[model samples]
Target: MVLKNILHHRFFENFLKYRYLLTELVKRDIKVRYRRSVLGIFWSFLEPLLFMIVLTIIFSTLFSRSIENYPVFLLSGRLVFMYFSQSTNGAMRSIKMNSPILKKLYVPKYIYTIALTLSALVTFLLSLIVLVMVMLATGAPFTPYIALFIVPTVLLTVFNIGVGLILATINVFFRDMEHLYGVFLTLLMYSSAIFFPPDVIPVDFQWILTWNPVYAMISLTRDLFLYGQMFDTFTLIFATISAIASLVIGLVLFYKYQDKFILHV
Candidate 1:
């Protein structure tokens, strides 16, 4: 297949052209995130910790028995929320943020964004360590099923890569996309089941929550970490399809418009 050959060559070519740059970009991103800071990487844990504590107080004291193990409940949402939010935001800004290099050098447009995605992955790994610790400390049961989260985690990574590609490419032309993405991501965060349980939502709204692709990731996370069980077959199939669709659309957009990107910027 001619398409397959092009992809094969493209993959090998980009692998050679951008791999080292990606590595460096990831390192720089990590350093910049913690540069001149006392907490350094420890600060990665702070957001969820603070959020979990506040939510625990509100849910346990204020709501009074809305859910058991409120910290665990919040952690489920927080983990996936942090990953999706950071990856998408980072990716959306990737191309424009690397304008200097983009203009002077010949590199794949997707690399700039992948660099950001990889950077976020590094931080995600670091934060996941704290997540595991918090889970153990909170007396949540750990089992082999916990490994199941890795599937959706990988799916979410691919999903972000696709999202980043589309946004980064559009941002090169529209420019306002950067600001727009921030607002959209904020809406996405609240709509995601991060702070609220889906069951508490109205029956009419419950399907929306379950049907939301992001909610699947968050709910699967809760299932694995909070309940230590895999979701039913339908949910997994739907999530995989959604993730793949996003990837196909994103790559198509990136390839279609990438040639004009340099001129746009």
Candidate 2:
């Protein structure tokens, strides 16, 4: 019942009404991001490729014997983490940066954040192609399990939008939130099993990975794409619930404070 009410809310109605506008905004964001760049869209493909090289070199030297298909494992986590980090960070600045558009037109505020996030999603998808190429280059098998890749990809996208909403809302009031978030992302990256396996971390502190949303996301993707491991129902449920909860709370908070945004920005 409560969910039905939320679905019919005025804000959501306006969001749907302005759906075309949102699409335009997303297109503009992508074009603007690569506006003057020489490489343009190819930069998206290059970023993950470069990171895969650097991380593979450093981590492989440390744990290559212990971990098979280390490059595939590292690249999968790196690309997903980069998507979340980049999406939230871009959405964080969307409102303030586009204050002119907000002030001039009376559109749903959430559209900006949504557009920014979708733009990042586009880039993330592009970067994922690099991961696929690396997997082939490294002779990783294409098992039937690989078909399940969409499950975690969709979950992670939802998680990114949720986190983006929260960050965009907070950054409106406190600009320093992005700076703090950057530092936090650094900690998250190192601790989330991006380059190293969880076993390397002290067993006592491994719970960090156990409870981490991003780690769960990365691990799930790796399990399907690289390891051919069976899915863990508990982990899937936990991660899905976390993503939905974040989206709901974020939407509620953003809706509550949305009216006040124009005044501040």
lDDT of each: 0.79, 0.87
- Model 1: how far residue 2 lies from native, Å: 7.9
Q: On residues 1-265, what C-alpha lDDT tens digit does candidate 1 reach at each position?
A: 9877977887567778778887988888889979989988878888778777888877766444665666787877887878777877888887777878889988777877887887887777777777788888888889789877778888888888888888887888898887888898788777786777666778877777767888877777777878778776777777788889888889999999988887878
Tens digit per residue, CA lDDT, model 2, 1-265? 9999989988779988999998898899999889989999999988778878887877797888778999898889988898889888898898898998788988888889989888888888788888889989999988889888888889988888888889989998998998999999899988898888779999899888889999888888888888887678878988899899889888988988998898888
User: Estimated TM-score per prediction?
Assistant: 0.92, 0.95
Best by TM-score: 2
**What lDDT is obtained when candidate 1 is compared to the true structure?**
0.79
lDDT at residue 248 of model 2 (Cα atoms): 89
Clashing pairs in 1: none
CA RMSD of all predictions? 2.0, 1.6
Best by lDDT: 2
Candidate 2: regions farther than 4 A off:
1-7
